[model samples]
Target: MSGLRQEIGQKAQAEGFSTPRFARLAHDLEQQARLRAFIAEGRHGDMAWMAETEERRGSPLSLWPEAKSAIVLAHSYGQEFDPLERLQDKQSGVIASYALNRDYHLLVKGKLKRLGQWLSHRAKTKVKVFLDTAPVMEKPLAQKAGLGWQGKHTNLVSRELGSWFFIGTIFTTAEIEPDAPEQDHCGSCRACLDICPTAAFPAPYQLDARRCISYLTIEHEGHIAPEFRVAMGNRIYGCDDCLAVCPWNKFAAAASDARLLARDALTSPPLSQLLELDDAAFRALFTASPVKRSGRNRFLRNVLIAAGNSGDTALVPKVTALLSDPSPLVRAMAVWALSRLTAKPEFAALRNDLMNSEADMDVRREWETA
Candidate 1:
C-alpha cells in the first residue's frame, strides 16, 4: 500500500473500522450478471427497490463515473456469544447480533464521513460515502479491495475480522492503487448451508431471499408465509444461523465500541413481553436500534410467530390480546399463535366468538387455516 493509502486506512481504524483497503472501480460484467440473474429470478422477494435500482447497482462506475478509487471499510460488530445457542430457549426471541443495539447505519456512516472528509481534503477531490442504505454492491467491492472474500453465505468474511462486520464505502475522484482481490477460502465447508433453518441457500453462494429468515422478518413487509413460520423458531428480528456457523468466526472478537453491545432486555427477549408491545412502547424500546425500522406492526407479527412456536401456555393471554389488534398482520399471527398454544375446543370457541368481527381477508384466512 502507498503511504497515503496506508494513512487513510489508519484513520479508518481509529474510527472503529477493522479492515480497510483500496479498489479501483472498473467494469465487472460477472457481478452485473449475477445481479441481473438474482432480480430476473425474483429471488429478492418483496424488496421491489432491488429491481428498480438494478442499473445503478450493477456497477460502481455506473453509480459514479467520476469515482476512480474506493476505500472499502469493514466495521466489526462480532457477537460476544453464540447467538444460535439461544434458539433452544423457544420462549425467548433470538435477535440478530447486528440489531442488538443501535442502528449500524448511523455509526458506520459517521465513521465513513470522517474518513471521507479527511481523504477529500488531503487529495483535493470530491468524495461520496455510503452505508448499507445505498444500492451499492459493497460485498463484491470489499472482495475486490482485499478486505475479505464473500463467503458461501454471501457475507464478506475477513481473515482478521471474520463475518460479523458491516461494510462502509468512500468513493473518491483521487486515484489510489488497488489491492489484489482476496481469493475464497470457503473450500469444502458447507456449515453455513446445512445449518439454515429454512434451507434458504439453493447452493453454495446463492441465496433465495424469499426463504431467508432475515428477509422474511425484516425486509419483507406483509404477512410471513405459513411455510416458513415453524422453521422461524423464535427469531423475531433477523436470523444468524448461517453467519454464526461460519468456521472463520473462530477468529472473531466482540465489537470494540461499547454502544454495540446488546441491551439487557433485547438479549433473548421474552416472547410474551415482546407480544405486549404497543406502538409507543415498541418505538421507545428500539429508539436508535435497527429493529425500529421494521415498524411496530410487522415486528409484532414476527414476535407473534415466535410466540406461536414457543408452545408456552403462559404467553396465551398476550397472544389472545392481539386478536383484536388494529393491524391485520398482528391479528393474523395472533390467531396462528393461539392455535399453536390452545387446544381445538378452546380455539374454536374463541374463533366462534370473534371470527365474524374480523374483516381483513388475510387475517380471516389465518383464522380459518388455524
Candidate 2:
C-alpha cells in the first residue's frame, strides 16, 4: 500500500498537481460543527446551496458510501506579479489571480479524471473525482491529507506553495495509507486579517462572507450595500488583498501550467471598455472563463460599482449610457455610478429627467435616493 501511494504521488506530480496525499474516509466532527455554525449565522450570504447539501458536504462517506480513501490533490497557481498593485490603477479592474486565466474547474477536473482512471486500473477498484463544483469540503479534506493547514484567513496555506493553489479530490474504494495532517504554522502573523479591505474575517479563522469583497463581487446577486462599494475599489470580479499579503508566499513558485497562466487582457482590463460590453460581447470575451458564470448583467453590475468608486469623471458618460439598460440590475448600478461621478446639481437634473421614464422599481429607487 505504501509503495502504491508513492507511485500515485509521482504520477499526480507529473500530471501537474503539486502533490497528492491519501486520507481515510472518516467523519470530520470539528469541521461539521464549524460548518453548522457558519450556516446558522447566515454567513454564507445568498449561497443557500451550502445549507441545502450540508449533510453530504460534511463528510466524504456520506457523499459516496463506497469510498474508503480520498486522494487529495493540490495545484499551484501562484501569481507572477503583485495582485494588490493592480488596485492602484483605478481605471482598470483588478480580477483575482485565479480567474485571470482559463477556468480552473475545467483545467483541474480534466487532470483529475485522467488520474482517477489510472488509479482505478492499477488497483482494479471503482473511483470518482471532484473539483470545486462538488459539495465536498475540500479544504478540510486537504488538511486531513497533509496538503496544508488552513491559514488564519481561513484559506489553505502551504509551507511550499502559500495560499495560491487549487484543490481537487478523488474518492475511491481502494484502501491506501493516509498521510499525517499538517499543523498550524501561522505564529504572531496578522497580515492577512489586517489587510482585508472589508474586514471579512471576524476572527482568526472565521469569515463573514456577507462583508467579503470577493463574495460581493462574484457570488452576490443584487445591489452591493453602499458601505462596501467604496472599499471594493476597482475589483470587478474578485478581491485578493488578504491572500497577497501572506508572508509564506516567499517560498512560492509561479504557475507552470500554461492553461492556468494569467491572460494579459484580463490582468488589468480597462473599466471603460468593460462598460461597453453588451450580452453578446460579454459572452464572447469571457468564453471558457469563470467570469462568464456571473452572466452579463451581474458582471456589468460589478463593473458599474467599480466605476462609481473610481472617482474618474471620464467614466460618467459610459455609466450614463447604461441608465436605460435592459437589465434592471445594470440600470440600478449605473444610477449609483452616475451619482458618484457627476456634480450634485447635474446629477439631480439628470435624475429628475430619467426618473419619470424609469419602469423598474429598483432602478427608480436608485435615482430617487440619489
RMSD of 1: 1.0
TM-score for model 2? Answer: 0.98
CA RMSD of all predictions: 1.0, 0.9
Candidate 1: clashing residue pairs, number: 0
Question: For candidate 1, what is the TM-score?
Answer: 0.98
Q: What is the C-alpha lDDT of each candidate?
A: 0.91, 0.91
Error of 1 at 294 (Å): 0.3
Q: Residue-wise lDDT of candidate 1 within 87-165, one digit each (tens)? A: 9999999899999998888887888888889988888989999997788999999999999999888888888878998
Q: Please state the error at residue 143 of candidate 2 in Å.
A: 0.9
Clashes of each: 0, 0
Per-residue CA lDDT of model 2 for 1-370, tens digit only, reads: 9888888988899899987877999988888999999999999999999999999888888889999999998888877898889999999998899998899988888999999999999999999999988899998888888989888999998888888889989999999989999889999999999999999999999999999989998999988888898899999998888889999988888888977888888999999999999999998989899899999999999999889989899998889889889999999999999989999999999987989999989888988886
List pairs with backbone clashes in candidate 2.
none
**Candidate 2: segments with Cα more than 4 A from true spot:** none
